[model samples]
Target: MTAVGDARIRRAVRAREEGSDLPGVWSAYGGLLQHLRIRAGLSQQQLGDAIGYSLELVASVERGRRPAKAAFTAAADRVLEAGGVLRVLQDEVDRAKLPRFFRNVALLEAEALSRFSYDPLLVPGLLQTETYAHALLGAHFPPLDEEIVEQRVAARLARQALLTRKKPPVVFVFIVEEGALRRFVGSDAVMHQQLEHLVTCARMRNVELQVMPAVRSVHSGLNGPMVLLESMDRRRHVYVDAQGVVSVRSDEDEVSEFWLRYGMLRTQALSTEESSRLIERMAGEL
Candidate 1:
């Protein structure tokens, strides 16, 4: 038997003890992978060796004890001659790894035709750099497990692919409070990288980034953060997340108010060009 690394074993043990309700997608993916491996007459060790991964990792994935990384799924698909079957589930698998409260909203956002959001504190996830992501997650309260943090960071990065997806042609507008950007998250260096990244994202054809000046104490968005998006079905929805609790709704009466609020917030925020310049200046100061 392959030796289970101390870290991995600890995470699995703690997760089991906590009795967290993991998403069902993981078990489904693991079961499907196992069936394919069995049909191919390959032992777990053989498959791991073929895919250049550890046998313990393979067993962990196969048993639904850990989520498979995209690279792992791709390699397993290729070696098993599964003809992209495993690849089809990659997005859902990644989504399942997110904090439970955010999973449903994330799925909806991934398929959005247009997404508009207002954030009073912190840069939105889509614009975060790897280092920034690491720092934010590492500082989570109650402290997430090392394995859990890695999983969430990877999932957040994966969700960013929606920004450039061409088939659906999603449009995005992000309004962030100037004070939020000015506030230090991880460190000056990390914030600098993050601000530079915001500039890069703003340059994207479909992304419009705006900043809400700190001087504005009273605004439509002062209430809290809100996301308004048009789903694949062209229905508008509202998403509210605070302190890890999430609320999502498609009721036209309720959603309409948020859409209107976001509209006002956009008008109140600095123009995209002005926001981009401000972000560059902040990066220089860092």
Candidate 2:
């Protein structure tokens, strides 16, 4: 069990004791767990002991204030003789761990035949190293529980597996701004490792890496970052995330405009060789 909102946990526990309807999926899951625990004649502390967690953690999860990990659900299923009832919800819980809006993008990326992205703020998830990702998520403004941070980091790393598939996308292009590379994330050592990883990824046969030089006075991507996906059926889509909102567009006219802008970005950005050299130099500087 991970520490979460203590006040909410207490309120939820009271609601469960009072037999009120649980509002959300997480709350429903917690209510079910509590019912199972009572039927099994196990106290929260007893369940915690059986599951190798603390009493507070068990109570936190039971109140819907903490996300239940897959391992915890599996153990609970067995301990409570749930006959796979709890285990069945593990996938749903895992998916819920990801930011709600980005879920569709994750699914689409897996099916895309070709993928291209231009990132100006930070390293794209697919290109980020584990350390870089951990540092990035750890700095969340509202602050996430350690468990949630690790869950998000795991989700981000899992997305990178697409690039290593036996038959990956036909073309994978990443256009990173020069300022993005120079931005400090984590520590100097972490940045060094991340840049080295970028250099290695650039060498992949199907991958194309380009850098938008900082010296450039004007560029087509000045508006913002965008990702274009070409599915196996030849359909194209564009994904854009501004602030916290995410939009995916499949309209031909809109996607074509993005495609044309991407072409211009490619023309204006440094070649793969030059980008790799720059990345190597940056890594060496660290």
Give stretches of model 2 more than 4 Å off. Answer: 1-24, 32-43, 77-88, 110-113, 138-151, 165-171, 204-206, 231-235
- Residue-by-residue lDDT tens digits, candidate 2, 196-250: 9999999998899999999986999998999999987788999999986999999
- Checking candidate 2 for backbone clashes, the offending pairs are none
Q: Give the runs in model 1 whose Cα sits over 4 Å from its true position.
A: 1-20
Please give me the total number of clashing residue pairs in predicted model 2. Answer: 0
lDDT of 2 at 124: 88
Instruction: Write model 1 residue lDDT over 198-255, tens digit each, in one string.
Output: 9999999999999998877888987788888898899899989888878898888998
CA lDDT, every model vs. true structure: 0.86, 0.84
What's each prediction's TM-score? 0.90, 0.74
* Best model number under TM-score: 1
Worst 10 residues of 2 by lDDT: 1-10
